[model samples]
Target: MNPFNKSTGRVVLGGAGWSRQIVTDPTSKPVLQTILHALSLGIRAFDTSPYYDPSEILLGAAFSDPALTSKYPRSDLLLLTKCGRITANDFDYSPAAIRASVRRSLDRFSTTYLDVVFTHDVEFVSREEALGAVKTLFEMRDEGYIKHVGISGYPPAVLADIAVEIRQKLGKPVDVVQTYCHMNIQNTTLQRSLGRFYGDAGVGIVLNASPICMGLLRKGGVPIGELGDFHPAPRGLREAAAKAADWVEGQGENMASLALRYAVGTFASVDEKGLGVTILGGGSIEEITENVETVKKMLKMEDNSVEALDLRDYSLFDEEAYKKDEPLFKGVRDILGEWIDYTWDSPDAAFLEEREKRKNQEK
Candidate 1:
């Protein structure tokens, strides 16, 4: 199997987060071209959910483009969709609803089957409800309408717990798990916990929170709350973000460079031999182009280290506390003072609670 397949490379590109940009475009030529360009690059994994506005419709449009399918058959690419959260509805994990959603995805994409189908509400659903839905998805897979079965949610603990259940109850490990483990506006301690946890779980994990952290980390004290959930540069995130921005500015490198490097740094440790696809969403062509270049640069960097840098050299860093002054953000003390101060209790921690659990379980 290709490492980049649903099993190995671990990178899953997100589609719905581009709802405002991709879905809103009816006559847009550039966006459609960019999507094709990405497909041409061997980055085949795509992710979408109904909650992302009209992502399903927009993606269908891109896939249905005559120029694209003519060159690359739909079978060449692997597609995954999450169910449970709908635009005007709450999270629903009922077996009937799950089956209907998969059918809708198959019908919308004009594909005969799904490459992978996730419950999307894995974290919120109880053991029994999840098992019930999982049963139906497996049946679909057995029937050849769905090729793989996966789950995704905001929280990793729930993700792990359910993943364990699937393995034990059905004797088959899940094919993929999606969660937010981005570079910027993220909790490092929590990320470490989850990465280590999932690594140990040996289940294929596709990270969705990559560019999200980059967008925030590239900033020098930018606002936090208003950014997209796909781009949440949280309130306190501005504080740490400012320091990183300053450092990049001082290095004479572009913000995009530092952001891309940091986004993939930790989860993609060279030592661990890890890899995953990340969604690089953009509101415009230039933004997408710039991001693509950044990803290229990050790949070309001399340092193969995927772990985040230790800020001890910059004076703003307190390695013991993982806290640094504004200079730590940039490697600028004064600049760090102006950032939005973030707390550990933020919801992001809950996002990676499974990492924490895995650590405890090991102990």
Candidate 2:
């Protein structure tokens, strides 16, 4: 049976944002407490990557804590990590490297197997290399080191095409596919490709990550601290998003909350079978609690409220709040203007050229 086919909840706790805090101090009690808090609140799945430095190590430490193990057993949780892309400009897609990465992740997490492992940021490397890495993951899946295999990147079309190609060549569909910054208020490109992912690619699950577009949709503009010094969005798009954020804030509404509501509500409404998942990030217990509460409220508002509400017993339904924020959502979208649905280039030309230069020297 496909591991993704099991119920993992609609929202996954993203480890990237929270892990950034502990890179210097991996044993930070506050960060570990945040993880425990999320688990206590019923978040069963976690998304992490070795590329995020100490993210894997931090999460491993959290899971190993007696506080977590005593209450939530390994079987009750889902661990999702990635391989291939090592840093902003480094990647290794060789089968040997892929195998080593998975083994290393296992050792770091102190787990017998990972629930899912994605070929991290496939667009950064050549298609052939990405496919080779994915094939290696499948072999590891068979060996029980991984339970599922998939690919993740910026371009939804590229991800869909790769999923189709994998099915054609390997005779099995990818267990899951993750695409970030494409399903938020500004960009809904991922929604358009859902049919292809489900019907054409036969993907078992599709994870829509970065509902806030990696902090691009927030009031403070694009973040440029520990995560990175640059954002992939062009100047015009960034300007438009700034205007949108200002509009939302002027109306006394939080931009990030509105974006999260729109994303969670939209995805939850369309995904009747619950095969779709949204990955959200938070840096503190307050942020995680707020995000989870926002998700709960959105779930309550969904047409299929019963199933979504069943995940948590508490009721967060507030029709009045929803009604008040509905207009703000539309207003922000209008402010986005022509930038809506736009996708910026990933692994931009400069990086591609640099990669080619390195490859040529090897020959």
The backbone clash count of each candidate, in order, is 24, 0
Q: In model 2, how large is the Cα lDDT of residue 9?
A: 62
Local accuracy of candidate 2 as per-residue lDDT tens digits, 1-363: 245433456668888774442234434537678888888787788999998778788788788788878888899889999998887789999999999999999998788999999999998877789779988998999999998897899989988888888888878889889999988899888877888888878888888899999888888776665444467788898888888888887888888888998887667556534545789888688989889877776655235444443344422344455566678778988888898898878878889889899989999
Among residues 3 or more apart in sequence or in different chains, the pairs in candidate 2 whose N, CA or C atoms overlap within 3 Å are none
Which candidate gets the maximum TM-score versus the true structure?
A: 2
Please estimate how well model 1 matches the true structure, expressed as its whole-model Cα lDDT: 0.56
User: How accurate locally is residue 95 in candidate 2, as Cα lDDT from 0 to 100?
Assistant: 99
lDDT, candidates in the order shown: 0.56, 0.80
Model 2 has an lDDT value of: 0.80
Query: Which portions of model 1 show Cα errors greater than 4 Å?
Result: 1-12, 21-30, 87-89, 182-186, 189-202, 220-234, 242-247, 270-273, 300-363
Q: Tell me, by lDDT, which candidate is best.
A: 2
